[model samples]
Target: MTTFGSQSDVIAFLSEPSAYGVSDLVKRIDTHAAIIFLAGDRAYKLKRAVRYPYLDFSSAEKRRLVCKAELALNRRTAPDLYLEVCSIGRLDDGSLALGQGSPVDWLIVMRRFAAKDLLDAMAREGRLEPKLLRELADGISRFHELAEIETHHDAVGRVRSVIEGNRVSMAKLPGMPLAACDRARLFTSSLVLLDQLTPLLARRGEAGLVRHCHGDLHLGNICMWQGKPVLFDCLEFDAGLATSDLLYDLAFLLMDLWQRGLRDEASLVFNRYCDRRAETDGLAAMPLFLSMRAAVRAHVEARGSDLQPDVKGRKDKLVTARRYLASAVGFLDRPEPRLLAVGGLSGSGKSTLAARLAPRIGTAPGVRLLRTDMLRKRLAGVDPEAHLPESAYTRETHDAVYAALLEEARKTLDAGWPVIVDAVFDFPATRAQVEALARAVAVPFSGLWLDAPRDLLHARVGTRRGDASDAGPAVVDKQLERDVGFLGDWQCVDARGDAQQTLEHAIAALGSECPIG
Candidate 1:
């Protein structure tokens, strides 16, 4: 054993594979606050001996505590990834050894997975399938449900702090690309919006909606582990940062996907999570949540430019930072509210079209997709894939579902957010009711009736798996027998072909009526 007494010695010891009893090849990755060393099947994360305004790891004791905290917090979502916190200690022979003697440094040991399995890498490689995204959304929703609710903090105050922090940080940045006027406008708009939502935020907090969540929920922090999406590397330094409205936590991933130009994927995750959680009421606050998330990323990226070693790297970071700022501003620039109803048979692609059109339709994070299947499942207190008995689809139950959908749409439109209803309006009364609901609210309404061949509809329903809609081939057959009387002025979308073609046709038919795209 070699004698060591300094930080450089500890680093040198860890840099060698012999220290880990593994291959000679050691991979090192550095972040602003931590250094990760990957050796063979295990990875060790050591916090940098640095202090920032938001975090401090300057002391060995503090680093050890944070390492333990990180293990505990991240284990909530990724128990398999975070193994344990190990101490790098001075052995009896005076050499630094992992898990051997008196502590000199701390590291969080983890089970290393392939880097290509990261959601960000999958997305970049175009391997991020819709099924995987749906699974990820469900995983996040479940995590939020089980997260501890924070009762001590004021939700509004937390958001206000973030808004103020972004402003102050940007102001302090030297040669920031964002204009002062632009920053002022965003700050003012955010404050105004916060003022309007204060009561709602308080009510949600009181209702236990504010939870200790995964603060940094971007795609990069998620990865495929054991054939499932596992969330790891959660914010652990600041409890205040991690404790927030669940939707606000969700907005980080949404903003990341939107910035990556994956609008459809972003919309799917949003709608899927909303469906699983039944969180339509919070849609009004999403724009602010998304803007705040973007702003946080902006200033963080801008600050990152200062940490870069070269001019080119700094310039690239600055450009990314500016784009994030622009995205933050763009999130607040909402369009006029409108109501879109996509009605057809069970497998006529109503839900598919609604999901596809949602991201293009309204404000930043897209319109509220109110699907009847999800509503029925929620009302029945069953999982979306849980089969519903025949009694569950009675006429009375059907009326109740439609009424709930209409009421939700009304509230969404009142909040100045667009909505898309996905349901089977086989009856003239139901179709008329939907049209009247939009008219009563005095918002532009577009009714799209998707028509497809019977065989395709039956086949589509037959192959359904893990879908909210429990409708089968028998249900499609029953729908085919129903007489759907004249859908006056409703745009008939021929959804007999592939999904993309059907979406294009529907968008073209709606044209200026649907000003979303």
Candidate 2:
């Protein structure tokens, strides 16, 4: 039986165009554990013959099993990308061949996609659009819904192990980029937060929030394929590492986006995902989740520095590692969250102002928005854009919708995330309800009342299409006839002008009360 001497020989074989039965050039992409060779329309991923504390692929049989596992697991999300696991054997002439000779190694075949389609590349080029992020969030939420829940898994123990692993990995790095004091503080603060959240974490595990997730969820592992974002390259070698709380899995992507200076995009994704899943109660764990995700990247970058061939590349990676380390500390110690409410008649630009201000309200991804229109749709079990009958607008339904909004806002605020409530609040009771909630939660609250000409309101709502709001000119007329009780402490902002002007006016009025950037 012909056997390859080392992984280098296998890499060399795969690096040639003849290996892929194509005349085109072959390109190689290397990572710590796998080498991917791209030729023509196909890509082959070969696992390295290396043994690490967390993973072992030292034997050919082990590599084969891992390759099969990867293909099976990744096909869950990226079915079009993962093809099959092929055996690499030898020919009669002692030459290497695929699926023909005595097995020496194995490779996972995948469909090659354009590098520019990678979400990381799109972010670097400022090509990540709002529509794309919304769709991506929807897809992620659906994926989490389908993930297998591990009822018997110890969620606390798993997180503690990760924290300990991070500690050991970072401490062992030669010439560690982080200060010893800072590293110790990060770990201590993370542990304290974990202790505080143990009960809630245990409840979430019991409620089946912990599942087998896409362990390595980040921009680099996602790509735009067939006009949508597809998640691939999941952590397959270790099932324990791949299984965790669904929110923790999502926190990796949120941390990645925030660290890339895409705060608005990050906030949009967060709000969209929460709207789909009603995951507001879990917001309390975001700080710890975000911090741990950042810490994971910090050590990973530091470890990558050791593999850099050049001094400059190694130094750059170390610098990046230090930056990520600092971010980890920052995420764990964010400022207190505030509660902002926008009240106005239908079509008075409250929704626009709330969306614009959300990213600047509090921490990295900003706040959760609780809009009456969206809540009504969610309560009715319909899509946000679906039209509702007039019966859905009864006084009882209105009261129910407002009650749901206030409850969600209270839950989100108590979870240490800022909130923006968008509703008419045309009655004294509804207005008092939200204000009382802020007082009960002991959070800083600011309410903005939008004022606009009746004609302007009519014109705005008349042109609406495919919006979550179902307000029309007739609805605006009804709101105008209704007496919205005295404004009290709420500030009035002029919405007669364009959306930007209204946003600026609202921000100016909130300057003293809200800590918006």
Candidate 3:
């Protein structure tokens, strides 16, 4: 049995540095549901004894259980950061102490990390590097792969519930800043998208795509730990809220990045995650997922606005909530899907152009980039940057890679997302096959064949390091010897200059079809 105690006493005890036997000052951070005290090298998180519609921590036992649950859940991705759950209770002589006498509340102890190490802080400071983003996406993919699959969820109903909840909350928010018509449109459009995606959601659930996932996978919840991104603060109060389609889980981060004007970073994370997970078919639901995630944020901010201590802080929060509301509406207005193929011999800067162009092509995070080299590596069950043997580059293997690339492009197109297939589509058959996929999918198609001097190509391939492509100078020589078929309808771009110049030419060739921001 647990005994209820005063929260102020617990807070005062945790706020004192001497409580941890440390001389350093203790810092405190608060949220609606919890309070964290940072002392020395550790953080103590205590659940607030409050009851909400979504969760209950009104009892000492409830708080203790939730504290234990949070520790267990977070340890899955951040084992080193989470230590143990500690009980706060009254000691002899009626003094509050940790793990001492009659238990009153519980707290999760965690290793303290620098505030600057948080991804959100890094994003605000323009320190989010591409390498870090890629690694983070890969880490997320691996985590999702190992998450327990959920089979009993009414996946569609769950999503529908979120949509309806957002609608209700947005409409009834205190000092609702949004116009009535705008709120109506947001709900109406989101519900319409939900109706259209109901079947796909159910099918994905049947396919075991739904799973227990980090319910709150935002940048703020991720931090740099031991030179890598570590996910923490997973939603532990409610399993029903935490379980979702993995793509839906990922959309929270993607939407977060996009909302922060980190479109390029968002695109990189999205593409890398797709490369790692191959969740291309779920792209159709992305608009809905992204919208719902933003809607959730909007309402959360709106509700949090009321808790602000000052008028200016309250107004600032409402302003942010409305901005998120607008973004939520925009996410649902997905553009028409398109297919683009970037083909060249090794060192023609085809991959470079594809990457630069993808973020600006369509929608928030842009196109799914499919590179044959990466595909080949994936086929061999190796990391994307791992080098392969010459045997892996056989004609049969090349054909198989092209086949797989086209199939993936087709699927991504069917999912109503733009795709850019990067490959050496030199042979007529390979070129025609990719072009045929666009026609089959009824999406606009464009092909850019990069033409660079043989010397430049040789120089490019010779100096390559940590690249997925195994092509060297010898491979470049062989490619130069083979006569590339007529350019046909594919636009030719001069790649002799630097990558930017080549991208400029390709974008010019793409013209109105490829919308650049």
Estimate TM-scores for all models. Answer: 0.94, 0.95, 0.95
Error of 2 at 140 (Å): 1.1
Whole-model lDDT, candidate 2? 0.88
lDDT of each: 0.88, 0.88, 0.88
- Candidate 3's C-alpha runs over 4 A off are 1-6, 177-179, 307-309
RMSD over all Cα atoms, model 3: 2.5
TM-score of 3: 0.95
RMSD of each: 3.2, 2.6, 2.5
TM-score of candidate 1 against the unseen true structure: 0.94
> What tens-digit string does per-residue lDDT give for candidate 2 at 1-517?
1122476667778888988799988998877677889989998999888765467888999999999899999999999999999998877888888887888899999999999999999999999987789889989999999999997989888888888878887887767666798799989999999999898888899999999999999999999999999999999999999999998999999999999999888888988889989987788888888999999899888877767889998999888988999999898865576778899998899998888888887776678888899899999999878999888999999999999998898888777788999999889888999899999999988889999999889989999876789989988999889899898999999999888898889989988778677
How well does candidate 2 score on lDDT at residue 172? 76
- Per residue, candidate 1 scores C-alpha lDDT tens digits across 115-231 of 999999998988878989989999999999999999797989998988997898788776756688879888999999899889888888988999999999999899999899999
